[model samples]
Target: MSFSLTTDARETFIFAAKNVFRDYETTPPAPEPITGNTWDNVTGNEVKEAALALIRDGKDPAKDKSIQELLLRWQLSQSGIFPVLAAENENQTLINEFNAAVKGLEALTPAAEEDAQILANAASRLTIPNLGDSYSGSPRDAMLHAGARVADARLSKYAEAAGTLLYLRGIQVQGEHMTPNWFALAPLTFKDAHRHSLRSAGTASPWTLAHARINIEPAANIEEIQERINAYTTGKRAIERQVEAALPQWQNLPRDAYQDAITRAVNGETMRDARGGIVTWAN
Candidate 1:
């Protein structure tokens, strides 16, 4: 076990004591654990004692990271102390192992180069993917359908107002004079109709018009939108499932290579955290 202070040792000692336990003030809450964490179980009072012990030994409590850290461990820690973390950390551990493997290949037969190359490739493959084409938020078909409904509603209202105006007064509303609205409106109407199976307006309810076409000169016939909403959603879901299904295979990748190196740098040893607990993942 190797433990070294991240910063100056005295400074580390100084900061570990400040406001670790105070009266009527909000203290930092305990942390939620994630990968590569070391845990401890000790009571709040016991933690306070650990801090006081630092002061007893002529050390500063406010600066002792371990004291505040132990406080976070907070009654759950039953582990031993002086968890000596190594001078070298886990990330460097892997790099050192990789370098050792590459070097060993040089000392071996011709086939050794190929094996080392595989190790290099595997190391590089460990990363998060951007996954561009798999964005599931587009919902193109659904959006098109929604847009159509809004457009139809607005058009219907306008037509109704025009009809009311013609009925009440002597103004003319030549919808044909509005033309096919062709340059844009007709095609938009067809898209909306195909996606949503919308009924034709102006032709009245239970619309008799077979397609989204108006009685205009040029036709507006296009295929209906696909039933499966969005291509992106399906594509993204398939990718997510594929990656999830490979979970077990992903667990030991570089670690296997790390162990296979000719020189096992950290073999038969336990890695320790700053608080003297075992670095679980490092092992």
Candidate 2:
């Protein structure tokens, strides 16, 4: 059946679709998978024995402190709270001591990297059957697939809205699907519309023309349309008011402080507190 939409509806749908695209593009990428063999070997009886031996050896207090710090840093790294880049130099002393201890332990067995790889391979081979079968793949893979499905569903809604808007504009639209799946649109004549009509009289009508092919480009120009809409809605006076509201006490600051504050604000390192006081740093 043929259908149509009003101009306001078309604009609103286009605006919403653009927002969806913007959000999708700005979403953060997934985190990297965990790595390294220390996590796997740290719990072994041999590792515990070696750690105890080091403690009982009556090592210098400074050496013992470095060993303790190294262990703490290793545990923190395993938990994903990696050492800060700026603190690397400060950690070098502890890292050297940790490496010495690790080297001593390695002399009695395979290298830590090699041992970790062996353990990883062994775990992979011990996979359970029928686990996550309902998802058609591993749990992590299934989760990614589900996310893609949701994105596709959202895009489909935008496509439908675009098609409706085009139909209202008297464009011939063809195809049942839209972008990220398939593109369908073709020109149509009155006779073609009539032939595909659902009307009881089987005659050509304005409603049948709603099935006309529509170009996808207009809907894709959402950014340009949004800019135009914003320009119309946000007048110069409104912008001035917003600026005044955002920095109400800008005129009261000393000249030097004002320039510094402006620089910090531009760099996103400063902001106004609840009481309109300037906060120069973040915790």
Candidate 3:
């Protein structure tokens, strides 16, 4: 069956898409204003006040080299401007200190490497084959598609493992019987006669006469059984690869997408059998 999203589900997808876009566009807060004492225990405010004092004294603060350096350093710290330092130690000034603080703050900022791709994918409105036409052209379809795809892939793996366990006991036949012997029947006999005679023959047959019953009990050690199942499913390295590929998209999903995926998984709505057929759970 094709995947289709309901009206509410579509709205959820749009909301998540908008969030992804907003996160991408949102600028990180400017590095917290560097706070510390300047040269000789002078604070940023003190440096600013001293520069103002020079101006009040009918002197150019810019012409006073010491005052100029302090004022420049104070300005750099407050303006969020990273100062570049010269190679000579003799010229080492507040600019070097400010630059160091800036570098330190930069190191603390987390990289936004995944932002662009996440935003583009959320906005692309891409479609997946399973979701079908119902989700086409919908806002944030790309993220929905990604979530559904990953959920389906996980379900398929689970179904395969479960189906294997189901088949381990072998197929059960309700009634074993042989085909009608057309040659042995009278030439004018009707088809009904042939069938009746075959039934009689089957009944008299030794193989059919015997009744065999084989009762299989659940594993004595449930924990061991669970461990084995986990070994068969979660322990597979390939499953990890699938998880890694889908995780970024999954992480970017909105709450609705997360809920939808979990609901489908628990309800077996996303499971596929060994033959790649959908497996619906009983209500």
- Highest TM-score: give the candidate number: 2
By the TM-score metric, which is better: model 2 or model 3? 2
Comparing 1 and 3 by lDDT, which wins? 3
Q: Taking the tens digit of each residue's C-alpha lDDT, what string does model 2 give over 1-283? A: 1234444544554454344335334321222332342232132344445567776787543467655655665565556543353244334433333333222322312222232233233234323222222456677656544443343343443334433334444443222121211111112222232234321222212111221221122122323333432342343234334334556675776777654553444344766743677665321
Please give the TM-score that candidate 2 achieves against the real structure: 0.21
Point out the worst 10-residue segment of candidate 3 by lDDT: 206-215
List runs of model 2 lying over 4 Å from the truth. 1-136, 174-283
For each candidate, what TM-score against the reference? 0.16, 0.21, 0.16
Scored by lDDT, model 2 comes in at 0.36
User: What is the clash count of model 2?
Assistant: 7
lDDT of 3 by residue, 95-174 (tens): 33323322332222222222222323433444232333345454556555555444333222222222222223231111
User: Quick one: best lDDT, which candidate?
Assistant: 2
Candidate 1 C-alpha error for residue 63, in Å: 99
TM-score, cand. 1: 0.16
